[model samples]
Target: MTVNGRRVPVLSAEGVTVRIGGRVLLDAVDLDVHAGEVLALVGPNGAGKSTLLGVIAGDTQPDRGRTVLDGTDLRRWRLGDLARRRALLTQANSVAFPFTVREVVAMGRAPWASLPEGDDDEAIIEESLAATDTTHLHSRTFPTLSGGEKARASLSRALAQRAGVLLLDEPTAAVDLRHQEIVLELARTVADGGGAVVVVLHDLELAAAWSDRLVMISDGRIRAAGPPHQVLTAELVEEVYRQPVLVHRHPVTGDLLVTPDRRGSRPTRTPVAPAAGAALDSAFVKEFS
Candidate 1:
């Protein structure tokens, strides 16, 4: 959207801050989600990536600053209204009741109930299930599905929503290798369809390959935000992740690959205290000599 000839972001977080028990989870972080692109939030554990995502999704209240959707404050929008525009797939896919997979996926259409848009709900649900490879489990109870199945089913729900903005937190965390690639491809498809997709990814290689932009968060603040090639470097990875790594391009795909550098020398001996009887064993060996 453009206002006064200026392009506006579909969703944005400005100076967003969140604190819990005097510990800062997010500190004055700003981010923008634009349509037709996939933006990834990546960092080590407890680096405020999820907290910032929740703030943008309106699931977590910010102690300072604000999050906006189409220039309107997120807090000002009604829950149902927000649900129609933005769908969030959280890390946990737990359902309290024994809802069938189909039933759980259908819940995404609740915001459009009694509206004309509900007419396509069934078709969308089926497409979503098939897209996520969850169609076969539609009749099964969500509680009975395996971890990867549950994750896909939950993703199917978010896809069924048809929201323009998707906030996904580790959508492929529990998925297998094949499904992980599938999930990333789906994210790209969503972005290609003109949706704004913001995903939290732990795998830097996947993020670099999938996302149009990468945001590296550390210590409750954004360390860098830019194109993957610019943001993901060997020095930055080592500094932020605190582990030496080798960042290189894939041989065929040409996309970036990040792997820990395991070239260090191993110690000659174990570093531990000897047992009480170890010296006596040494003396017995000496007697044999």
Candidate 2:
């Protein structure tokens, strides 16, 4: 497939599985990501979302199936070539030693070391910072920045790579609510710019809000894969999460929203008003009189 002069189906996996200590972490899972599209992987904790990202990012090889990038097996690509064409932002990224934001963002350029260091690099770095809304933090130390700020900086580093495929694992974790929107907006911008994005998200609402397609995983298998409105139904949520959830369209945008119902497990009880002329009421009335 092709989209806006970029390759559609930029990354794909077939029968991918991961196992450890004879325990299956992921079972025969499959997914496809296209350029100019955002595909979200959503599931509960221990559902293999992050492990799937690792498989797609070439950090881990599937035990049973194949991962293909742009029609070629991912294993065939050279490390440098893969680095130049794809970027992976893992869940935990920390700067042990203090480094300025600019230096950190510059690390994204490591794959293109042969290229001349000139205005282009600076421009790319600046654009990445601007896209992630971290330009103001250029002079700040990475260790001194807040958790949200660090996430934005890491995102900027990935953007600076200018790769055609982007993979993220829990990109919004540890960020404040406001920064969550900011990070997701940047992801949308990346897709709009003709890149393919695959993200693992814990928040179903965020996934429904931003994803062009969704893949729901459970017990390492693909439970559902399709548009959010179609795949994120109440029945599917209950089946995969073992909990009741309500699916409703946003009143304004009409986007699908998934909300877990905590009251599902508790019996409904109606409160009764105190009976008139009861002993408690009579005592209060006598005192007042």
Question: Which one wins on lDDT?
Answer: 1
User: lDDT tens digits, residues 17-108, model 2?
Assistant: 89988989999888888889899999889999999999989999888998999899999999988998999998876988889999999999
Tens digit of per-residue lDDT, candidate 1, span 48-127: 99899999999999999999998899989998899999999999999999999999999988898998999999999999
Clash numbers, per candidate: 0, 0
RMSD after CA superposition, every candidate? 5.8, 5.5
TM-score of each: 0.91, 0.87
Where does the lowest 10-residue lDDT sum fall in candidate 2?
271-280
CA-lDDT, candidates in order:
0.94, 0.88
User: Quick one: RMSD of model 2?
Assistant: 5.5
Against the true structure, candidate 1 reaches a TM-score of 0.91
Candidate 2, 168: how far from true, in Å?
1.0
**What lDDT score is found at residue 75 in candidate 1?**
87
